[model samples]
Target: MRRTPADVWLALPQPFLASEALAAGRTYDQLRAACHRGDLTKLAPALYAVHREWADLTPAEAHRALCRAAVSSLDQVALSHLSAAVFLGLPHPAGRLGKVSLTALRSTRTSYPDDWRRVLQADMPESHLTSHDGMQVTEGSRTVVDCFRQLRLRHALAIADAAAGRGLTTPVALQAMRQFQAGWPGVLSAERGIPLVDGLRESWLESASVAVAHELGYPLPASQVWIHAPDGELVGRVDVLWFEWGVVGEADGMAKYLGAYDDDPSPTAAGQRVLLERNRERRLEGLGFAVARWGAADLRGGGDGLARHVQEARRRARPEQIRCLWRQDLKDPLQEWVWPPPTRA
Candidate 1:
């Protein structure tokens, strides 16, 4: 049977089990064969679906398919972490497929046999548990906390950003929740990841910019800022802007420039592009903004390099430089601007 676009759209970026596909009036063997022949993708054992031809599959679809498979398999596990973030309508990076993270109480031993991982939460609170679309998962707050414990700070920040953006977790509430979990790791994780959620960035670059700055004692900027032209057309916002230093920092990861070349040839064109950014930089510089460009090497490398870069930009900076940069240009005046450079001298 030909499933509707909606049905098929709901079963990607994660696998579906055979029996469930059969119940949906789709032949499992047919889909399996397509995956075997490279016509489709097998997200897990006996789970099959047509691959998305354009963009990556949606998170809801991934969760739906995984939940369906778990239910059909009669498994006790439920989606969690990045997968759960997707299910909860929180944005996450689609590339990492280390696991279709699942959480279950009392630990079950079923295995996917391919492209799946099972995570056990031995103490998942029963009251904070629920089933959605056939899979079991911890409630929003619990899921957010669990992910913070397991994933990297950036990934955790992504989950928290999504959660907070949707009002699922507020700083005050989360901070209060931390009091319930005692011990070293719990305390450390809470200390590190909580305040970051108040204003999380949409992209990994922005998140990294936030973290690195915080780590290096440089005040983090308002990420993904929107700078508009006088006519109201959006120009562009720097990835990171120090409103107090008149310094605009961007994480110029290789992907940014390389992605443009891959997406279209025009961005790499001689006069068509190189000149475009040059003009953009000139306009920003003319506004008394000093733009500092950092790449993936600096971000992924570590603190010393990034610290030096930010420090050099702040050395000898005046309030007027930042004052005009924010007030006249970006329209945001930062109050945290320290005077006398904090006297390291």
Candidate 2:
């Protein structure tokens, strides 16, 4: 059958069984035919999917599809934790097709060929569940709770920020979820992930800046602060800027500097990208902005290390800029002065 947008929208991501096909007014042959031709993707027996490729499935759409497929097995499954996270389109790891997470209330086991996760529970707390298209799921608050419990702090925070960005959850919701979690897993997870749950009102970099500040007890610098060169050309906007100290902090997430799904045909191309970043940082420094750079490693300790680097940058810049100027010569200050760090010598 020629699948229209509406048809595709109606079809779930998982494939259906012969019985399900028959129930839906489609014969077993028709369902099998669709599967054989790649028209429908079979997630498991009686679980069928008709997705628009990975790019086509929005987080909500993916979650909805997973719900339908799981529910067809007799409401025996509900998406949970990172799996629910993926369905919600939160940017955690395993962006690709990994194990699809499934949770059930009663002690009934299910089998599937595809990667599947099963969580069985007697009671999952009403506060923890939310209705999405009339199906039950771990609420956005609870999802954030589960995120830290189930994954590393950075990954959990990344998911939390993405959810916050999408308006799926709130910092207050995170706090409430933390309160409700009673077990050791819940307690520890909430501790690690709660601070990172602030609703930062800026880009991903700004969010990182907030996390770093909270983790290190350092004051956060102004985000998206504009810095200019001598000739009036915008040298660049700093990710986080210390106005008083003439220092600029930049979080260099590899996904930003290095685009995802890299297809490096030539080794020189990678080297050239590195050279370009170096040049960009050098130019920023020339604009009277002492730059402190960081990456994924800097985000370790849930942003403690990142904040320290920012602090150090501010300390170094203080001696040079007793009076901070919005307009400073676009020349290399580091070249003119030699305030060197003293070694053991």
* Best candidate (score: TM-score): 1
Put down candidate 2 lDDT per residue, 97-165, tens digits, no spaces.
Answer: 345556675657654454343554524666667767666677787777777777765567777877786
| Top-lDDT structure, candidate number | 2
Q: Count the backbone clashes (under 3 Å) in each candidate.
A: 1, 10
What are the clashing pairs of model 1? 16-47
Q: Write the per-residue lDDT of candidate 1 for residues 159-277, one digit (tens) a residue.
A: 77667766777777666656655552555775677777744455656665576667666664666655444344444566766666767676765455445445554445544444666
Write down the TM-score for model 1. Answer: 0.64
TM-score of each: 0.64, 0.59
